[model samples]
Target: MTEQTNRPVPNPCVGVCALDENDLCIACQRSGIEIAEWGVYSDEEKREVWRKIHLREQGVLKE
Candidate 1:
């Protein structure tokens, strides 16, 4: 496995779990599916989710 793949990615959950109308978490901004499957996701997959969350926070991506 690559370095990134071997490294652990932190979960984005802030313990304020609530879904918006778009089904995205109001706190972490992850989709319901992403949150549900997070435990099974590879480090790379988790990183990708974090990237999207960053984009959402920056207004660079939506949904």
Candidate 2:
């Protein structure tokens, strides 16, 4: 069996897979570039992305 390393942050993709007018994913609130680069980012980087997402959700940041 192939071994799997635990992901520090679970992927935010909810399979909505659509970008809104501002180019942020309607579901996960991540930009297309962020989604594309997610797999290559380190855990720390992923955490940072998550931070931004949470901020957006809370209206502390914009898309």
TM-score of each: 0.87, 0.83
After TM-score superposition, what is the CA distance of residue 63 in candidate 1 from its true location, in Å? 1.5
In model 2, the clashing pairs are none
Residues 1-63, model 1: lDDT tens digits: 787667689899999999999998999999999999999998778999999999999989987
Q: Report the C-alpha displacement of residue 24, candidate 2, in angstroms.
A: 0.5
The clash tally of candidate 1 reads 0
lDDT of 2 by residue, 1-63 (tens): 223336467899998999999888989999889999999998778888899999988989886
Off by over 4 Å in 1: 1-6
The candidate that achieves the highest TM-score relative to the unseen native structure = 1
In candidate 2 the C-alpha lDDT for residue 19 amounts to 91
Q: Residue 45 error for model 2, in Å?
A: 0.5
